[model samples]
Target: MNKLSSAIWFRQEQDTLILEIHVQPRASRNQIVGVENDRLKLRITDAPVQGKGNEGIIRFLAKEFRVPKSYLTILAGARSRNKRIAVRSPRVYPDWMTGSIQRALFKIS
Candidate 1:
């Protein structure tokens, strides 16, 4: 594991990146709001009714990580604000993440 994996918000396992996220639905905008209680915080404009928030999270994360929506998965907390996501072979890391994480994403083995 790389140094960033030790962080509670995210970890890298093989080619997959696992993220611990706390989402606040029906917010003023859709954006990453840093970490809270060891999980990455996010504010989404979509309401939490009828899985709209979950879909919104997937769409937002897909764009942030530069991955296809099919490459993203909600591993846990689909029915709640707290969620765990897995990104397979992500092409890029969001600028909000630490610089080390950004470098790690493109590091060749």
Candidate 2:
């Protein structure tokens, strides 16, 4: 594991990257707000009702990572503000995930 892979919020298992995230629903826009309490904080526009928030999260992440929605999976916390997501074979890494994280991902790919 590299530096980012050892962090509380991120990890890598073979071709998949796993993220521990904290979500804020019903925000003005969807955005990644950095890390808070060892989790990746995200502001989502959709309300957390009947999985809309979860769907929004998947959409946002898929766009960020340059992957299809089918390549991402909500591994846990589907009904809560905190979630564990798996991104399989991401084609791009968002700007926020810079430095060692990017280096590590590149090495793996």
Candidate 3:
């Protein structure tokens, strides 16, 4: 298993990192809610139409991970709420993410 295998929300893919997200589009604000079943629950203000929400997701991820927008890509589920995205060369991983990962590991062990 990979270093992040204990966590469900994301995993390292070679140099890049992959995020499994459950997006709540048209939300009042954009933010990361929590982790569930190995997926990160994200709330975004944009509606899920014409890829607007998808764009918002990329922007949010870029800022959160401290990477450029171009570094993030929608790997799958562009239209669906459940999305798999890849982020290249991230410079940050917030405490909430590491806490979640620890909780997941605690649950496993």
- Candidate 3 global TM-score: 0.84
Instruction: Please identify which of the two predictions, 1 or 2, would achieve the higher TM-score against the true structure.
Output: 2
Q: Report clash pairs, candidate 1.
A: none
TM, every model: 0.85, 0.86, 0.84
Q: How well is each residue in 26-63 modelled by candidate 3, as lDDT tens digits? A: 99999877765668888999998898999999989898
Screening candidate 3 with a backbone cut-off below 3 angstroms (N, C-alpha, C), the clashing residue pairs are 8-38
lDDT of 3 at 88: 92
Which rank order by TM-score, best down to worst?
Answer: 2, 1, 3
| Candidate 1: stretches off by over 4 Å | 1-6, 100-109
When 1 and 2 are scored with lDDT, the better candidate is 2
| Whole-model lDDT per candidate | 0.85, 0.86, 0.83
Q: Rank the candidates by lDDT, best first.
A: 2, 1, 3
Between candidates 1 and 3, the TM-score winner: 1
lDDT of 2 by residue, 1-109 (tens): 1323324688879999999999999999999777777788899999999999999999999999999999999999999999999999989877778664865557779
Best by TM-score: 2
> What's the lDDT of the predicted structure labeled candidate 1?
0.85
